[model samples]
Target: MIKKLLPFIGEYKLETILAPVMITIEVALELMIPFMMARIVDYGILGDGGMTYTIQMGSLMVLMAIIALIFGALSGRYAAIAGMGFAKNIREGLFKKIQTYSFANVDKFTTASLVTRLTTDVTNTQNSFMMVIRMAVRAPVMLIGATIMAVSINPQLSTVFIFSIPVLGTALYLIGKFAHPRFLDMLEKYDSLNEKVQDFIVNIRVVKAFVREDHEEEKFVDNAKRVKDAQLNAEKLVVLNMPIMQMTIYTSVVAILWFGGNMVIEGTFNIGELSSFIMYIMQVLISLMMLSMVFIMLIISRASFSRIVEGLEEKPVLDDGDADPQLKPENGDIEFKDVSFSYSDDAEHAVLNHVNLSIKSGETVGIIGGTGSSKSTLVQLIPRLYDVQSGEVHVAGRNVTQYKLNTLRDHVAMVLQNNVLFTGTIKENLKWGNEEATDEEVIEAAKAAQAHDFITAFPDGYDTELGQGGVNVSGGQKQRLTIARALLKQPKIVILDDSTSAVDTATDAAIREVFREHLNDVTTLIIAQRITSVSDADKIIVLEDGKINGFDTHDNLLKSNTIYQEIYESQSKGGGINE
Candidate 1:
């Protein structure tokens, strides 16, 4: 864990070094204050008792206190700035790394886990860094300085100091060993509780629709209880150290006073020296106690850091297409040659079997299948969302894997089944399709997708702020907006995966008509469950169990394709498409 954090601090090496240096200076000043107190008592008060010497020593003590306070304040300010900057750099780096991860890599770490790492885990590490620089350095310096001062004042009184050091060290080591595993468990419970709460909030509508509020509440309660219990156990182990250290400190102080009194009575040490020795011993022991607490915090932070490093170290399953050269295709043609894929290597079933297909430029094709028939999966492969397990996916007569991911995705625009709308104005969402697009271009795309009329009807028109996921808009409006966003891309190929399902049949027909007229030269692939939705396509492919069951024109398929015929007849008789 220390090794992982070293790189984040590397860029701030100057500040990191400077912060500890300032802390050391502050600790030295603090040590001098004690010595100054000893001087005032021994020489200024008990000596010939000259007014000049007393006044001089008293003035020196005031100067030392003021200097200590200034250095302490400087150290604190520098430590805070350095620690916060380190945390910001780390969080930004992690967020960028997450953006580069492939879909497969993202699936390995769930959204809830990522959120916890970005927030709670990073906060723990940041707190530890701040405490280490701000207080951890000073505690050790004070402890060692006080020990030296005590031994110098009277060697016989230093015996208690030596004994108390070992007792504190043992307590810190034992508490750290016990608390490390508990801290890891406690963080895991925290992530589980976060996941449960996120799920409940995101699916609140579903829960209300099904009247399962009590069920969800019970589930959340159970997860929260687990987190509470784990935290309590961790706190119990950590809090035990303080009382044990206090016991050692009190015992050592009692022994120091008892033994020092005997030495003073025997004339081996004077009253003033014994008093200074006891004061130094107390200072040393208290510093050790504070240091022990800092050590435990570092232990817990290390545990959290390990989890964060694990996420950063993960490699994306899909390569960035860096090693491969650019693929210059002959034309906008796509071919899937014996393609097979699965979500995982150990999965019992593949989502797509040995499927083969070819689509020429300027062609319109439709893919019809039941739920889980891999229609969406086939289109996802075109943009390389998932790598083919056993075959090649080619674009423009060249393998897609040979092109950079961004270059390939640039030519292929996809409107997914699950349409997502970010929090922004309608114009802003449309601009995501093409940032340089003019207002005229946006209006044209919106008109083609049959979204212009409704958008203009809104009070603010294109400037209206869309709520999260377009919650303020109807489902049909959201679908049309997504379609408009994709249309504005004007790519070589457009894939609409059941994009028109939310709109009424009349609106769907109008959008299809616009697509036919404006996108005549664009290669289009439509995946739909409604036979009426794809009946006008030049070709239709019916899929069953990951294999092509039939491939023909829609009219020809009505007679030759059993699956297509069944779907058509069912929908014609008021039986909705199964998917």
Candidate 2:
């Protein structure tokens, strides 16, 4: 697991190496302080060597302390650099990988789960990396070095460790063993909590409209309580680690004082040497406590790292990397050959079934279907948003899979059913379709989308800033702006998937007129529920039960296609899309 994370360390390799080296130096110098104190007490103050020797040893100890402090500070700085740098790299890597994922890939993980992995999971893993580089080096070095020095001073006194060490070790092993799974459970609860919060925020207006604040609050309380319970279950075991280590430490100290007191009475163990031995024993116990802390943190971070690794290592379900980069769509013509698609692999569960359709360049085609008839699903295949489970989608003259994704998608622009806008100025949002679009081109597309008149009414005009998802705009205005943005692409193929539904019929007619007159070389596909929206199209397609029931001119469809006649009559009785 640790090996998988190492690559993200990348340019931080220098800091990673330096942090441990600094910790080693700091530990070595700290160990010498007790030895120096012993010399000052035993030889300078008590032995024939007098005040002058004591002063010399004390000065040397102060100098070593200063050096150790410097090294310790340096180690902390390096660890911070390495840990933070590692986290930044992983975040960028995860986002980059996600961008390559097809719609099917994104469907595998929810938006909330991905956000938690990027934020909470990455933070936990970074802290573990810092602890390992700093405390991980300090604890074991302190333990081994203190043990060796204590043995040299009095080997018989060191025998106290033979009893105490095993007891502390056994307690820690049990704590870690039980605590790991609980931490995993706690992390799962965090994902759920984040999902709940995210869903509420995205739909806050809906909640208020329905007057369901109290119900939503009660659900939040339940989720928070689950998180608290899971945390306490794991933390209860981890808390045992400290009390057991403290008990072992205090027991060893009392036993040492009793045995060393007798040796002092017999004048065998020097008083100064006994003091230093006790100090070394304290260091050993404290180091053991630190080591235990490092292990506990690792247990917590292990779950977080696994989630991050799972996201990082997920293979995007779509790949066009090996396709010909130079292959370009020559015309707007599109063809579907016996295509079948399912969100799942089960062919019987398909949303689009055995579909065959061919659209000529510059033709305006309307697709009408009842709900769940797969009108949107059919158009999505042209740009390869999701691959067909069987058969092929052809653009221009070649199968879509033969062209690089960027090349294929660049020439096919879609204004999706859900219009999304980022936080930016009007100009900035429009430029998403064509980053290099000039001011003249921007105005022309807006005019063609019937957005220029309303946009100019604002004081800021093209420079007006939009809120997230363009909350400031009316539904009809948002739809027009998205249409303008898509038009800026100057794509060979344009798809409006119920995109203009919010616009008034008059404006909808004007936008269609613009497409008919101006986009003479571009193939246009309009998916609409209103029969009037597609009534004047060069051709109309009627879909039913995931298959093409009829594909012909609108006049012929009204006479022959029963599905089309039924939809037309139902909407006619309802007075059309205005409802």
Error of 1 at 462 (Å): 1.1
In model 2, how large is the Cα lDDT of residue 374?
95
lDDT of 1 by residue, 22-86 (tens): 88887787777767666666776775756687788778878877887888778778887888888
Q: What are the RMSD figures for all models against the true structure?
A: 2.2, 1.7
Q: Name the lDDT of candidate 1.
A: 0.85
Candidate 2, residues 243-340, lDDT tens digits: the string is 88888888999999999999999999998999999999999999998998998899888888888889888988878878998889999989999999
Clashing pairs in model 2, backbone N/Cα/C closer than 3 A? none
The backbone clash count of each candidate, in order, is 0, 0
Candidate 1 regions exceeding 4 Å error are 49-51, 321-331, 575-579
Report the number of the highest-TM-score candidate: 2
TM-score of each: 0.95, 0.97
lDDT of each: 0.85, 0.92
